[model samples]
Target: MSKYFKKADLILFIIILALSVLGFILLRKPASDNAQIEISIGGEVTEVHNLDTDAEYIIETEHGYNTIQVKSGQVRVISADCPNKDCLNFGAISKEGQIILCLPHKLAVRIIGGEEGLDAVSY
Candidate 1:
């Protein structure tokens, strides 16, 4: 019984170490110069934008309103009518896989990278 407990302890330690390494890896976001933006409304994709161009966009819905701006290779929510204004406070995001959400209006904005994983159809 004691031998079994020792093996279990060793296995648990290895699992913890692996998880710590993975967490550290995940913390370091990959740098991306140019990326595509995918914005969704009410759980459906509504718009796609690129970070290479400078532009300003306004999103208005019955639930709320938000203003998004892209400039100099980054995107951010400048202003919004959401109660908490969480999106505006989120500042700018330029890295892939970063996301900005306006929960009150059910809006989601995400950065799409060039190196994507296999699609469902491919698998």
Candidate 2:
């Protein structure tokens, strides 16, 4: 029984070490530098003249209102008229699958990136 236990422990340690090394390798890889597109629910598309300027756009929906800001090379929600203010607290999300939801406004903000052109992002 003791021999079997020792072998099992060794196997577990080897597996853990392998996983740690794999994780480190993955973490060392460079991140993707893709341009992000901003979409607003029930809002019209407008061109921002000044790329260096920081501006906020207000979006009003049936549920509530939200303030979106464009800064640096990204866009994010700065504030919202929701009760919990959770949407505003989300700060910014640049990766795929990351989303900002304002239940009051029935609004959702997401990042979409790919090789092909985006046809549309559905709820």
Candidate 3:
């Protein structure tokens, strides 16, 4: 057992683990400040709302309607008339680049304009 297990080997394993954790934390993107929600329908910019203000907005499209709520610096779809209602399951988003889409209604709500990250990704 001593031949296979050494103190140096244990120290090296711990060092590798610590470095991995640190790398993960440093590489992860942080949430943005002064974020705002952008609402678009049919590729047209309809409206934008600040996350800091608490309000409710109803977006009416040719297909249907969606109710959006902004409160406590977070935005979410409180209710919608879409068939799937998938937007409601998105909960709340306060981070930049986060989006909630209602495909059936052609509605797209996204958080933008604060501490933007890398615009493109390379494999």
Summarize candidate 3's per-residue lDDT along 1-123 as a digit string, tens digits.
387988989999999999988876664334456577899998888998877889999998789899999988788999999999999988988776677888898889888765355344322
What candidate 3 gets wrong by more than 4 Å, as runs, is 1-31, 114-123
TM-score for predicted model 2 compared with the true structure? 0.51
Better of 1 and 3 by lDDT: 3
**Stretches of candidate 2 exceeding 4 Å from the true structure:** 1-34, 38-55, 114-123
Q: Which ten residues in a row are the worst by lDDT in model 3?
A: 114-123
Cα misplacement distance, residue 118 of candidate 1 (Å): 16
Instruction: Name the best candidate (by TM-score).
Output: 1
Candidate 1 per-residue lDDT, tens place, 1-123, comes to 484578779899899999988975774355455467778998898888877779988988889788899888788999998899889877898777678888888988887764454353466
- Report the Cα RMSD per candidate: 7.4, 9.1, 9.9
Q: Per-residue error at 69 for model 3, in Å?
A: 0.4
Count clashing pairs, candidate 1: 0
Candidates in order have lDDT scores of 0.80, 0.61, 0.83
Residue 106 Cα positional deviation in candidate 2, in Å, after optimal superposition? 1.1
